[model samples]
Target: MDVPLPLVPAKILTAPTTITQFPDYPKTLILEQCKTIKDLNQIHAHLIKTRLIHNPRVAENLLESAAILIPNLPMDYPISIFEKLEEPNSACYNLMIRAFTLKQSPNEAILLFNEMCGRSVRPDEFTFPCILKACSRLHALMEGEQIHALIMKYGLGSKGFGSNGFVLNALIGMYASCGEVEVARHLFDGMSERSVGTWNSIFSGYIRSGCWEEVVGFFREMLEMEVGFDEVTLVCVLTACGRLNEIELGEWIHEYVVAKGLKGNPTLVTSLVGMYAKCGRVDTARRLFDEMPRRDVVAWTTMISGYSQANRHREALELFHEMQKTNIVPNEVTMVSILSSCAVLGALETGKWVHSYVMKKRMKLTVTLGTSLMDLYLKCGSVGNAIEVFRKMPSKNVFSWTVLIQGLANNGQGKRAIQFFNSMVEKKITPNNVTFTGVLCACSHAGLVDEGRGFFVSMTREFGIEPEIEQYGCMVDILGRAGLIEEAYQFINNMPIQPNAVIWRTLLASCRVHKKVEIAEESLKNVVKLEPMHSGDYILLSDIYASVGRLEDALRLRNQMKERVIKETPGCSVIEMNGIIHEFFSEDNIHPDLVEVYNATENMMEKIKLAGYVPNTTGARLDAEEDDKESSMSHHSEKLAIAFGLIRTSPGTTIRITKNLRVCMDCHNATKIISNVFNREIVVRDRNRFHHFKDGSCSCNDYW
Candidate 1:
């Protein structure tokens, strides 16, 4: 059965009349009715055949229809027609220039403007604004200044033009976009009369230059002067508010939007959401996001990113899931934020899903998105994936290289990390302070004290990069970890800058490892002076006392902690299974599967002990019985999380866990034996670094 074509209406089916058919009919009216290039071409053919192509008014109208009116019409069609013209007036030149700017060909617009000048066409009010806009788009400051002089020469300045706000607004925008924000501001301040557009121009100018404080101050000035603002003006000020985290002013803007009935604009609402989110008020952002009658991709992304920035990763992931149910597709920025949340939560499956989506969408692996994905893989203990992401990147920046190096260092691939640093230097990429920090950390983790020292000095001498506190801390770790405790103490004393508590704490941790109680006491005293009420310092000092068999001293230190009501931060471990994250704290008793998990933990402990896993109770309380000390050591957060994973997950599946604090010696030892006994691989990410356990050994070789 053949399908019949749908019948057409008589008006659309009728053959269109050409200019030759009705010589008296207005050709411009026919030009105005053109809905496609074919319709225009028919009229154009008639104009040429009837010798009406030479008529300036008729030809200019044709150009207007082709360049501006008709949808999807190529600009080259009008350009070719204009070139064939014997002479075109200001209107023809202005049409082409404006069309060029709208089509994102600013250089062509400037070239046409120069040709207009060569022909001595006096630029009208419309002429300058179009050309200035072109200059602004190109960031051509020199050409913009030449045009500004022309504006002044032709009496188009504020003093001369009287009320031509468009000209002044373009001037402001051009100067600002050209990076001459001060000049833009000077023009704005000199205006005897100002409009909302004038304020928006200056506001956008300041924003472009990162002068956010200036924007907020001027917005307040606008309010004081009782000026009216439109959606653009409000959005500009709200952006400044978001960047500066000015919540009070942001709230005020929200109120004004409501009172003035401007809440109907989605852009203003999204700005309010962004402002509140940046100010650490995700609840308000979420409320505003929910109240939106319709949500766009930008709005959804802003809200999701807000949760991520607040360190509320679970909420971020939840909102992302909600966004997935909507028709709006997540953009590159949204994926980056989701990946960051995944990294912090150790959600490897979720991160992998996002990666596949990016590939499915055929989106470019931009530097930022690639770096974010690499960070996620590294933090999730997917070292192979991280390396592949780094390798496949189209281009690399210093930060990209730094992330790879730091991630490798954190994953216990320290020697390879240093080789990458060397490769980076050989490629002429100068190491910044962060790069040096990663390099030094790599050396510190690999116990390369001499190499760490060399990099520290070379950072200042060879690269001219000054050592920041992070590098200083890494150097302390390097010295202390290598049993050079005396030199580490002397290094702290001889430092130019004041040592922070972290540096002292690093020294103190090494004291616990080497049982240097006398130096540990000195480090503890300095740490106390810096951070009074720090529980870790007291705990470290007490452990040092117990390690040296000074049981009475250890008891007294514990008593001092009790008298001060100081509480240690409990260990926490996070594991992800079936795309859901589970958290376990020390001696946790609240999980729904607590009974099963406890039974599994007890049975595993028995098996590990039979496999020669002896518990190291050095940090346990000296006042407790030996059995009680060993019992306390058995229930660390990572162990419980591991037990839960082993019981719930299928056999042969790798268990990846992230802990809040560094893994204790006893748990580290037990995890190795567990991996061997169960014939499964286990990856543990503690506060310090990663421990990949398999077949009765760890990647760190028990040094960490």
Candidate 2:
């Protein structure tokens, strides 16, 4: 059975009045009674109409009546009533200040406090707490201290009610928020009285300051002292748990939350799901989400982002569609997660839908959304749309700048990519290692080895960011592309961090490019061991075997790959067809355009041959028969696609092709020949590198 949420009871304190004699009731006694707002307002209206509140005692009654009736209302109405008096007493002014402070306009409270001076009415104990409240909310430590000095001057410091729970709590909050934690603690410990709010403020301060151990220890101390947990405490602790990657503590908190029936609170549930997800337990996050009684937009967003961070991109997209099944609207956070999913999966259609949705719904998508949109288009192989999104953004942060730089770099616009990076530095928006990674990648693709080295050194010296393993991979790729094999290898060895699989693969690919078969074999072992789950290492090793004239060993490696227990990543390619795009890969040939593509390819092969394109079989086995080597190079999928693009498009039309693997040297040569013969430009973005073929030359310069 579903239950209802907690309800807050309305409360108002009425004015002191004479007890009336009714059926032997006490005469002239103090009247203390609760009255509704209408009852109180009627009395106030009568007093204002009659001008009877000119009496100090009558004015005090009206002030208390308004405080009781109007606390729920905005302070503006109450302040107007208080301001109307030719002059109100100390109590009247204090209530007005307190009301304004609680209404979130504390500056007005302070300004009013200044106006109270030189008035005949003296500020009593109530005025100090009220003014201190304004100071606390404003985070005006200097003003709070001044108020503190006044409290001592007025001799209200030691009075228990003057230095009451609310006033002391505000002082603690003010000190903690201003980073004076020790002072805050000293005051807290010395206080004879503390409320639940007092304890919560201190615990929250510890969490915000990243004092994780203190957070844990204080939570325990509170429990030991018999202070119970609240939603705010759980939220703060769970946030700290996520940052600390404390999955065990996170689970304990989740269990506690579930037992206490706190799971219905969306904020707590969101925090728990996010905590589990951030701790690398997306499955646990989903489990928690499933058990929850209700879900808000934040809960759904947390689950979506959890899948994203875990790289379960398909699941993320699935969640996005599922969220639409419910009435809850997707916010900017929801769009951010979906955009990340699109970026990972290269889902251009889904990304386009989100872009249209943003426009139609008039959702105020932020700069992060714009940046992710640019990235999604680029990853989906739509550089035109990526550039369009980039131009539309009003402002660009480092991520925004990096996306465009990376997009241009990925599209083989290296000179423009470098120029963009230079522009980023000039604008004083500091670039992170990820930005430099893109620039370094561009240099590697463009064979800007000198520039790569210069940037590599400057990234450390100028920015103080120590290079990570990926940066080392870029340096090796830069030198490797230039055929400076030994220098690339030496640079990897000199790296402070251990080289990962990508670093070794860069060296091996360079060896394949330069036909240095012996070195390729040595590098292949490291790459294979580094990522044993992936079969590209084995495939690459076999290619080196084929290049070195060891056809038997190449076959042996292929057989070993088949026999290995681990599954290989299937080969894949996306093709644009009709008004939509289709993906076909790995022994699958069901594309509608397949027959047309193949026939066109057959015709263009002849034209390419007539143009004097000699397939470079140096990447094949050295001892293999010439016929076998030539046959393998002839029907490569990338070459087939390039030929199809050439014959299917117009004479001068630019051919844009995307492949799932690095376009081989033989295919690169064939593409260059076709580009020159057909008098067209061909842009092929393949796995591992990009190639811009034009006038019998490639942007990779035949190095990749």
Candidate 3:
């Protein structure tokens, strides 16, 4: 029966249906179901065959699918489809613009918005947030302000559409991202109402601008207003706390997080760990790290970095090795921390391993990482490798240049450091305070007093950099080392700021060197007044007394020190050989090769003595006979480390040693003789500077 009826109108039965004949299911619902571009294309063909392409609803659905549903589709597909629309509304424009913004083609979003405006489609609340976000992504303050102006022109800020939280938050974020924090703050202040997101936006902006104090203030205000805080708020505030070293406040925030059951959050925990570590609470940070249920790369890196910053290099390396055992891969940040530890420990072999790993992983030598590597090699007593790393770096910032300059100066290559500094200036790289510090140090080490003075003046007059306390210390060191004790005293007296303990200590050290008893007494007075608990100050003053044959006075001072319960920081030296680090303390005999090391030391001392080396007992604090003093100097920590290194390493291999204190005159003389006798290059990095001994001479030229 049906076939018979259809035979009367075969053409009508087979023809395409009208738009109204389609299913009642929403086009948007159908679009949502279209998971892929292929599905969307089928829908597009159906829309065309049903004569529904003219239906704005169907067209809008098709555009949304093309713009948002499929991954990595060409923008041209959406744009062409949108262009074909007869009268695309603001909603359609917003969809297209949002898609472009999401795809990181922010300029295209802006163009689409302009086209929508030209077509006379009035933008609504939804339109502005998308555009503002686009501006944020592009960091285009000018474009963001224009969109803001459009919003203002439409009176959107007063009520209904313009006062939307999303739009306002997006506007604030855009301004902040463009480094226009003040403008963002003005808007934030005028907001009649705000969500937690608004507060977070302001906090993040302050953090990005390095206005950590303002971040703390905003957090306090947020707390006072009883606004709810999330993990983002805690992370930002914790970071501010760490920067300011506000440990007490950070602890309270930590307590708050724990109370809110947010401590389990990996991000908050990592921030907490970093905060504690930066605030000088590394032990607490480690405790939190251990308690974490699971650690991400950031957490592990933060913990490792915390230890490194605290100068706990052994722990840092241990933690780094532990991190390797896990599945989490190390990023540039982790490698930097590891390199820093190796630099401090002078673990050249370990540092080489890290360098090799960096190459193996194909990690790009970013400015920070490259600079860290250079610092590591230089600090580990391999100036050649450091220079190589520096030259191969693709880019150099003020910090990178400063690290190389400082490294050269520290490694007794002062003239070369100055040359590098001048080259940096010729390249128009503006030097920072640290840069000036390094250059001044170079001038001091190289005996360039006049150049040092000129640069010191030029720092303020030419570069507008006001010298800090460290710069003044370097200048005093320069004059003091050159035997201009009176000039140093005058300079300290005329300083614009009050001299700190370090300044007095530097002067006192110079007094000891120049045998200026009167100046030594005055410097010790100021040093004790500033740093009453500093054992080195008392020790140095006692040594000066002993040097002047005032043995009774020296004895009385030692007794006073014992009564005051102040303990000296024991001198320790470390040497790395065959990928192992050997540590030696003053008078230490704990190494497994102790007998061989001492035998080598005795033999080396005999040869040095035969070569006209005389043991200078000026550094021996004990009120003992000259023979006892000579024996004490022979067994010093650095000498033991050197003897151990000589016994372990191959012939002619460079011997590198790191000491916690300055090398005494006796050890310095003996090292020069040993370098000549053994035909080896000896690099000794002490508390202040480096000494390169070779062929009966030192690189410092006896100035240090």
Candidate 4:
């Protein structure tokens, strides 16, 4: 069945001539009545054709109708039609200002106001609001103040749209954004007709400047005044709570939202999750996430970012995957969380997949995304790939260069890392504190003592970037590796900022290297005091005692850990092949090819022992009967990983192993001997530095 078109309204279909017959004519008309500008021009032609151009009411209606469509119709045509009218009325002027305001042509509207006033076609109640709106749109405070003066002079301040609360609120918002908050407050206070929006504008002003306490105070005032809370108010309040970490306040807002029946609003829900997570209440965030009836990109993104911030990388990865399974398109923020999770986990294959996903989705891979990808690659022990990504980037920023330099340092290419830093400087780009920290750290890892000193001075003198705590830590690492334990300690004493745990630990490690017993005791105590919860503190302290032959003190420290009931985090190694990660632990013997792994490990041990290798127990707790800890060090994870590699691969293959802890001196020594005896190269990447083992030598010159 065919549907018939509906008849148009007769009022819309009829003409202005009916007004005279009806005797109750509208004083003004809208341009939409003509249906087309051609029809409108024809009406004007008929005006002149019928000699009704002198009819005052008809001329007023025609000009007003043309001005009504000024913004919507061609601007030039509206101006032309308006010029043809013998005497355009104030109604036409009002429509023109409204039209220009809608078109975002505030300057034209202001000029039109001047023209109207010149002709003594005085503005009425509607004129002031449009003028104020124009001033606000241009952010012209001076002009806005002039209009405000005019408003007061015409008594429009109390009479018309000037007294309208929303218009007043717009003025307040403009003034606040222009850094005239006091003026805004004055206007707000003087309002005889203030709306709730007036208060919201002030509240948002505080939020923009990170003034959470003021936001809270204003919100309280709003509550006390019984001004109804809206969604905008809730979002702002939640944002303030998230920044301040006032968990109790945030929770109260949550309950308020629920009571107000706004629980399921997506923006409110997302903000609540963020607020809870930012306050370190991940459980509450999870509960809200679980209860959300519908999840948008913002909700998923908030959960993913929350997990990332809380260091729950596994959950972040899981949620990202879930988002994909549900067909919710991930935005740039979502990708950042997923990339960060991969970086922390060193999930290279998955990161590579994400890069592919970026390409498939036609994402630009902007500098931020590219830099994050490089960091992920570096964390995954793929500096070559990071460098490649950096080189291919369309635009590079300081952060991008810093990540590359740090990645190189992380992967043990100290010289190359320094080269990258030098290139960054030569590019006329200034290096930030993070970039210098990475470069200096590279020099430390390679035992480039002179280079470290040079860069440290250059950082302050040339770049004008003062050495921060991390930079100080790197210098200590350098000097300590050069057997300058006292110098490192003196450097710490002279530091501008207080030395942190890394500084104390770096000095302690050097003491172990140089067998500096006395300084080691003091450094160890300071480290434990600074970071008692850090397992590395206890472990490093124990190792220094063992090196100094203080067996009793070593045992006492271990017993103190026992008293505290602290369990050591065991070291583990992982490698990805064809997409799956194979995890190996020290002394692990559970591989399906366990027999082969054990036999290969024994043979390698015998070969290295023949090369004058001894299990150097520098890292053992001295209190443990010497042989027991020596045996334990022999079963370190890197060794087990290399042995498994030898059993599975052919001879002469370069073995690579990454472990979760600092490689003890015994493992370091053993790897060097094994690399020499087997006539092969090996790379051992540990928590602190990388060891390139070849021909009974290491890249660190046996200092690290």
TM-scores for all predictions: 0.85, 0.67, 0.82, 0.70
Reference-based TM-score, model 1: 0.85
Better of 1 and 3 by lDDT: 1
| Candidate 1 clashing pairs, residues 3+ apart or interchain | none
Give the Cα RMSD of candidate 3.
9.2
Per-residue accuracy of model 1 over 95-193 as CA lDDT, tens digit each: 999999998899999999999999998888888889988998888999999988887788744456434688888999889887898899888878878
Ranking by lDDT: 1, 3, 4, 2
Model 4 steric clash total:
0
Clashes of each: 0, 7, 1, 0
Instruction: Please give, for residues 1-704, the per-residue lDDT of candidate 2 as tens digits.
Output: 88998886687667756323321221111123425455456555655666665766666655665554443755555666787788787888887787677777889888888788756566776887678767766778888777666655665537644466766666676666666678778888987777788887776656645677767777778878998768888888887788788888888988898798777788998899999999998898899889877898999999999999888877888888889999999988889888887766556668889999998998765688899899887776577888888888888899899888888787777788899899889999999999999999888777788999999999989998888888888999889889999888788778888888889988987886676776787787777778776777776767777776777888887777778865555545544333233454533466566777667666776788888977788665444689887765665666555655555556786656656777666777888888888788876667865577889898666656
- Candidate 1 regions off by >4 Å? 1-164, 174-180, 621-623
Task: For candidate 4, write residues 1-704 as lDDT tens digits.
Answer: 99999987766654444212211232333344555566567676766767665676776666666656433675666677567767877777777777787777989988888898889887766776677667666767887777666666665434565676666776677676555777887888887766667778776656655678767777878878887878888888888888888888788899988998998699999999999988889988999999999999999999999999988876787788788899689988888888898777656777899888988998887898889889887876677788888988899999999988887876678899988888888998888999989999888877789999999999879878888889899999889988998898899999989898889988887887787878887897888788777776677667767666776777888888889877788878755444444567776766566577667777888888887988777675455577786666767777777887776657897666667888877888898888888877877777876677888888667756
| Top candidate when judged by TM-score against the true structure | 1
Residue 561 Cα positional deviation in candidate 4, in Å, after optimal superposition: 4.1
Best by lDDT: 1
Which pairs of residues collide in candidate 4?
Answer: none
For model 4, where is the 10-residue window of minimal lDDT?
18-27
